[model samples]
Target: MPVTDCYTCDREAEFDQLPPRERIGHDSLWRVSHATGSELLGWLVLVPRRHVMEVADLTDEEAAALGRWQVRLARVFAQELGTPKTYIIELGEAPGFHLHFHVVPRPVDLDPELRGPKIFGYLGRPEPAESPARDALATRLGAALDRLNE
Candidate 1:
């Protein structure tokens, strides 16, 4: 079931209509999409197909699938972006926001100040990542994920 007001639920409801950048890939339990309003390329968000307000709300199956998706997305980052590390974060503090995990790529040459949790500073920047670039990476990353399943 989905919460009527949740962003994740709204997107999930339109999964079939979502663009490549919005619907990178998904399975029975989870969905993956490139983060919007962020300047950082390859910033991905992992969300449950259903509305989940808290991590504890996840069923055992959902939890397992979440771990698998996290690892797979990180692997995709390593292979596609040459990310030295990836930060996985979940903060369901905003109203109408469903639980989601942020899989942010840590660039090899990232500024020391932006390392670790500070990397979040890249989000909601003055200028968002260009759509063409995001879409291109989405296509490539989506293909990489497909290959990994082979």
Candidate 2:
């Protein structure tokens, strides 16, 4: 996607204006946010601050910090939300979607039927904006991220 039409870039523009649920945390290279239009909590997304569509396009500094952010989010999810593990994926396939990684919290009791890639079902079918549960989780996750990063 062109920079002008990129969804992730638009969201970055709305940085301070975004709702609490939309802005979780960020470092210099990557921004963490709750996935929009999803019914899940702790369904965090990690996107580069700059507009680059593929992993190969990442600068050396961006590549270096990428894995650390992934692991930190996973650890925060486990500590705060009882997530047993996290599912990290980067398809970079959707048009205008920008390059981002999904760091999904797989709870200990997740149904056997939704294991592995099947868990992607939790995405897309999202609750409305200002969803109380998702927003609340965002608050908790935000705080947890602070502690974890500290």
Candidate 3:
């Protein structure tokens, strides 16, 4: 379906303007990175450059490229974060009517009770202390993406 006036479209310029530390990677049509203030490991988000509400609305090229990017990111997360599995998620209740995917890395040691719902469970909760460990992980993942592009 055709799109108009969606927040993602309106804010396309702002995506590039996001600081370097927040950026994980970007192809022609999508931008990917870790979500700000996430409490878990390797919590990534992939957002389309254009505004679209649903995955089915993606153009054929976008559909193909999106899968490729997501898979590549999953590999990077696993390799860099020591995650055993990666969960690709799409929860669309937000101001940005743009299609996006979440690449959540699942570490083997995660508490079973906190594994699923609690991964992103603290989304709106008060921010946690600055974790040097998470910062290091992000640096490694960002460096990994840079190497992949080489």
Candidate 4:
């Protein structure tokens, strides 16, 4: 059951028309999108194709695919951008924001002050990376994901 007001559901419904950044990569059970309104370049969001509000709601296959995606995205970021670590978080607190996992790259030079949960300060901040830049990075990352899928 899809929620009419859900952000992820809204995007999922427009799968065919979504921009490259919004459909970076996907399998039958999940989709990856570049995080919008954020300065973080490689920040990606892994979302279920169907509407599910909690981890318990996920099917066994969905849960398995979710872990694989997180690992693959972390590996890609490490190989391509040399991010020492990646942060995976899920906080479905907002109204329209449904259950989605945030895979954020934590570079070696990242300010120690913004480590861990505090790194969220990078999101929703002023001066987010522009659309073209996001699209380019998404395209690059998407291609990397494609190669890995091979």
Identify the superior model by TM-score, candidate 2 or candidate 4: 4
**Candidate 4 structure quality by residue, lDDT tens digits, 75-108:** 8898888999999999888765578999999989
Per-candidate TM equals 0.94, 0.90, 0.78, 0.94
Model 3 lDDT per residue over 1-150, tens place: 545676446555666576543556777888776665666646778888777678888999989989888888888877777788888889888764577788888888888876775777745555463556556666788788778778
lDDT for each candidate structure: 0.87, 0.83, 0.72, 0.88
Error of 1 at 94 (Å): 2.0
Best-matching candidate per lDDT = 4
Candidate of highest TM-score: 1
Pitting candidate 1 against candidate 3, the one with the higher TM-score is 1
Question: In model 1, which range of ten residues has the least summed lDDT?
Answer: 1-10
Clashes by residue pair, model 3: none
Query: What TM-score does candidate 1 reach?
Result: 0.94
Per-residue lDDT, model 4, residue 145, is 88
Q: What lDDT does model 2 reach?
A: 0.83
Considering lDDT, which of the candidate structures 1 and 4 is the better prediction for this target? 4
